[model samples]
Target: MTTDRAMRDTDRMERPAPPAPEPLPRPVLDSHVHLDIVGSDGAGASPEAQVEAARAVGVDRLVQVGIDVESSRWGITVAEKNPAVVATVALHPNDGPRLADLDAALAEISAMAEHERCRGIGETGLDFFRTTGPAELAAQERSFRAHIAIAKRVGKPLVIHDRDAHADVLRVLDDEGAPETVVLHCFSGDADFAAECVRRGYVLSFAGTVTFKNAVGLREAARLTPLTQLLVETDAPFLTPTPHRGAPNASYLIPLTMRALAEVKEVPLADLCDAISATGDRVFGPWP
Candidate 1:
């Protein structure tokens, strides 16, 4: 018998043995993932298979974010081919030097934003955590400013990737007249910073760090931030939530992070799901 036919037969037998109720769906929207990395092998299941795995765990949509010009183009191409995926194009803070001609890079990003499947501008911002020199920091700042300019010019939300440079990031964003909707993606700051972002009408996106045993500060921020201002992401093939920590990350791990957030906020999982999904929709524009 065909696979579908076998599943039907098994369902029929299981139904008679004991009235099996439907399984509760996993409520999640993995706001970020790196399908290009996951699909690089192009052999086995593929990144598309990863999407299927995520779907099995209740993730309905994912934003495929690009870290450089080539990755941005690949992200857009993937989104165009997959209805469940949306693309965000920008040079990551660490990739600042690669974009020597800021204007030309911005032009390319802007063009990608115009694509029907492209949803936002970023995964961009400052990363003091990784800068090697004053020159590197300056380059990162220049690239960040360029990204903000593009976000303003395109009138789309900005996805920020601040790491150990919260003050500088905030300062630059303020100086640039903050984009329409700013998201501190994978927020790892303290409650005060979260409050500051909330005060500025920026969204705070939580990642797997919230699930770490040593992440008291992140958990506090998760608890303190208003539900409407909170967002969630995988930042995967990177920050895998606990139980799966150090494993190859994917959108499928979002529930583990969400469960941690739900606990932090003292809210039911379903309610937390609704609030975060709504926040993501508001910030990114309705999923395509």
Candidate 2:
């Protein structure tokens, strides 16, 4: 898959700016976001401003997810300074082949996992879509296993990035004995797949993509996810929700996606917000 940053760059020229939605009835945390990349959208605010904007709209907390070693360290730094942010570290599956030493990269990620602000090990998992070559796929799998071990060893939640490889992701997790806490970040699956994830007790994190008009399958998955296993995120700088599909995304835009999710689950907006907030605390531990 194309990098989130690249997509955002293209989107900047093609789409109109998104108007902010009404603030949520209660606070909800964005379980996965790229605050670093989101800041690059020329029209976007600084990371500090982004955080403040999110807070003003009832998005009081966020999980800053890293896609590589440099970004992982940056995420930790951001988390250290922001009480509302927690970090998750890992090399993205799509980045495996580009790394000169996957083991060394994993080692750094492991060390980062021990940080107090780093509450999860993730953005790691299979991506059959982008990695079609056998060697690249092998490297991706190796990196994934290493991340799983690190998460289990450190006793932190394991955040997964399953993109067009849901079955393989589950197979690998089952083979390696998944960490106690597993989250399917930006969950991309159908109702049946959602059942599989639910059976394994993995949390399903919905992003702006779920609100797209063509995301019927995603909507089904959202509806199928239990209240306790549900989480919401912006996946900022990418996958901006409908009415803002082509615009640059940020944590502040989460209320639009959350409202869309509430509609899909047929739950009251305030109740869904409460559930998502509580689930965030449960999945990643209480926000510090």
Candidate 3:
């Protein structure tokens, strides 16, 4: 599967910017985002500006997710200054193969994960989509288990990034014993997988991709997820929703995705908003 950042970069060259959708009746939280990447869209938007834009559109709260050491620390810094934002620090599944010292990077991530503003440890899990060898796969699994340990030790939610390696992800979690709270970021599974995750007491955080016309399977998964186990995110500047497909995305665009999710779940939009907000607080704890 193509990474969201790669899609965002190519989409930047090929599509027009998406117009913001109607604001939600009740505010909601974006459970996962990469403000560092969103801020680098060459549009010159700062992290603060992005947060402001999200708030303007009823995305009042957000989780700034980190995929590497620099982005993790940067996310913490952004969270420190922005009350609307909390952060998650971790080494992404893809990061293990690139880091010169994986252990050292994980150590820094471990230290940073303890920060008061850091509410989760992840974007870490298996990614079979990009790995080219067994060694790389082993490294990702090793890092994933270590991150599970960190999240457990810190008593924060474990946010997982499962990409084309769903079974392996579940295996690793079972092996290490999952943290009390677990979130499957950008949940990309069918109904069976969704049922499995839900059975394991994991929350599934849907992103803008759920709004895509071809995302029938994803929509099915969304329909099956209970409100208490549901969360929403942009994963910006990627996975821009329908009528704006292939365009750069941001938190301000989440109402479109939220509305799509509401339609899929056959729930009132306002109710979905309230549920997602409640789920956010439950998964990440109260934001300051």
Candidate 4:
């Protein structure tokens, strides 16, 4: 994807801006976000402003993830600046080929993992949904393996992003001795897949798509999965939840997503929030 020019302007602006409203009072953790994308959206909100908005909405913490090496580094930098934001560094599947030197890339990621603010080792996995070609598939697999190896070596949870490559992803995770904590970020699979993942002790993180009126399949997956294995995410700047659909998303919208999850699970909203928040803390480690 092309870089957003608006983000560059925000980075250059010299004056400090006003603070955002405190996050909402819910016990939620936004497991995925793209702060650079959100900040670049031409909205008045800066990255810091977004965090404040999330706080105002009751989100306790957020995990900002990167899609490429540059963004991975930026994710760490942003996390370092915000007490409520933790970072995950990995080359997203779509950007897998960008890592020309796999070993060096892993080394850089390893260094980032040393930070207290860095919580996990991914946003990495297979994506057969987009490009297709023997060469591209091979490249994606290579990158995915490299990321898994890094997570194994560093002993950090593996945050997976599987899109239209569920079978292959499950196979790889099984082969790789799947990390102790495996989070399927923005899980878009069916109930069977959800059951399999839960059986394997993987966590299924739901995004705003769960709130869509026609998202029967996702809702089923959400309900079928055990609450202890469930988590919620914004995947912000993308997958904005219903009501807020078609607009830019942020961590602040996490409760709406959680409320939807509560509806699917047929539990009270407070119970759902408590379970997800506790699960997130256990998986991601303490909020920095």
Candidate 5:
């Protein structure tokens, strides 16, 4: 008979989250994560348990991001009940082509944006890697522009998910006039892309992928970014950091990424944590 951890492993969840790392010297937010997905994926922790675990490690806040209408609604509800969580609402670009009524779907997303617990609009923008053909790509562009409008109208930050489509993402933002605040969630751009984002003053949120030994470009991007323009996330249950890459990830594992980032930027660990903490408050506003 298999042990419980082994049994859960057979179900395809990433492995159980690693032991809690030492707490950070200063608190900072996991700028993006999918707590609902973590719970559903047999991550061996409830949402409340995840939050408590994160808090115990100095990750005092989180921004639960939604990729579709259902997940968006769940994020908002989670935020409402958890003081440590704030929600970001959006329809994932790849999900754009599947919607029977794109406009109606967007309308619901827009309405959700009005909730006080919802602090950002995104995990949106574009994904050229997964999308092919004009019709599907067109749907993503339309949804991206619409999400930008919602973010601007609500005066909240626009969280972008740019994957292999840096140029198009910037063009659309330029054409639509980006919201007052914008973030590139799990920023996957190169040094040149990082320069442009820096010039435009958008925050760059790095994930655990930065800790991968072969992620030279990502580490370089981190080095180029100023502390003020930087944020950290696990994008957990997904991009678990090195030494724990194959394991399930949670906010409690943030210190591992934080330390990696500090090394890349050549800054003291405590100082970098403080800067990221302050930037979190700046971009997402005070958590309620």
Candidate 6:
């Protein structure tokens, strides 16, 4: 099924999340994930289970990303209740076009963004692949620009969701001027695009996709990125890492992605964890 459909499809949730892999040498943070989505999906893992399971396997910190008003509020509630979790609020590019009153919705997003538990503004940016019409694309851009402005005003990291629209994403960021801390979550770019982002000092957060054998370019991007600008995630209930590719994904499985990243970066796992932890602090501020 298409990712757009899957994100909205609760009925066809994948099988339960897989068993956890061996713990990492040191702890690291999941830079982006959807615990709300995971809880609804087949995994049916509670927030407590998801956080503790990841912590057990050295993924102690979690960032629950929001894609709409309802989810954004849910993320704030989740973050308030879980010390291990922080949240980011935004209108997903796909959802932006579907909103009835986008401005009113954004106003709520802006208000939620100021909460102490909310660490950033995004999972925003552009997506050309799913958006076929000019009107939808225009709405996405309008929402993206508004999200960027909100992030800047709030002085929070802008966690971006860029898919198949790298150049335009960069164009808009350049036009609006980016926040001090910008994260390309679930980064889906080639080495060249990665290089451009790196030059601008944006954090490139990788998901389980980098573990795919066919993701040669993504691996190269990982290799090219300095550890200080790098982050990892499961984007759980979606990009399940290798060895457990078909099953549902959760924060507990971060080691699979972290291990793959360590191999690609050719660094000791402990060293990688150290770098990720430091960068996580820089990007999200230490989790409450």
User: TM-scores, in order shown?
Assistant: 0.87, 0.95, 0.95, 0.89, 0.94, 0.95
lDDT of 2 by residue, 1-288 (tens): 126443346645345556667999999998998888774442355678878888888999999999999999999999999899999999998888778988888889999999999999989998887676899989999989999999999999998988888889988998999999999989989999999999889999999989899899999999989999999988877778888777778888999999899999999999999998998998776776
After superposing candidate 6, which stretches have Cα over 4 Å from the reference? Answer: 1-12, 39-44
- Clash totals, every prediction: 0, 0, 0, 11, 0, 0
| Candidate number with greatest lDDT | 6
lDDT (Cα, tens digit) per residue for candidate 6, span 1-288: 015533554533545557779999898999888887674443346788788888888998999999889889999998999999999998899888998999999999999999999999988989888887999999999999999999999999999988888999999999999989999999889999999999999999999999998999999999999989999998877888898777778888899999999999999999999999999988997876
TM-score-best of 3 and 4: 3
Candidate 3 per-residue lDDT, tens place, 1-288, comes to: 126443346646345556667888999998888777764442226888787778878989989999889889999999999899999999888878777999999999999989999999988898898789989998998999999999999999999998899999998899889899999999999999999999999999998889888889999999999899999988887777777777777888889989999999998999999999999998886988
- Over the stretch 1-288, how does candidate 1's per-residue lDDT look in tens digits? 001111222222222111111222445688877776642221113667767767777787888887778889988888878777888998888777545686687678878876767788888898876578988888889889988988888788898988889999999998988988888889989989988999998988888888999999999888889998888887765666776565556676677888888889998888888888787777765766
What TM-score does prediction 6 earn? 0.95
Per-prediction CA RMSD (Å): 9.7, 1.7, 1.9, 4.7, 4.5, 1.9
Q: In candidate 2, which residue pairs get closer than 3 Å at backbone N, Cα or C atoms, i.e. clash?
A: none
lDDT of 4 by residue, 1-288 (tens): 112223233332322322333333457888888877764342245778777777776887888887767888998888878788888998777766545676677668778866777789888888877666887788788888878887877788899988888899998887777878899999989988898998899999999999999889889999899989999997866677777566666777787887778878999888888888899889886875
Tell me the tens digit of each residue's lDDT in model 5 across 10-106.
3336345477788899888899988876644333457788888889888999999988899899999988898999999999888888789999999
Model 2 stretches astray by more than 4 angstroms: 1-8, 13-16, 40-43
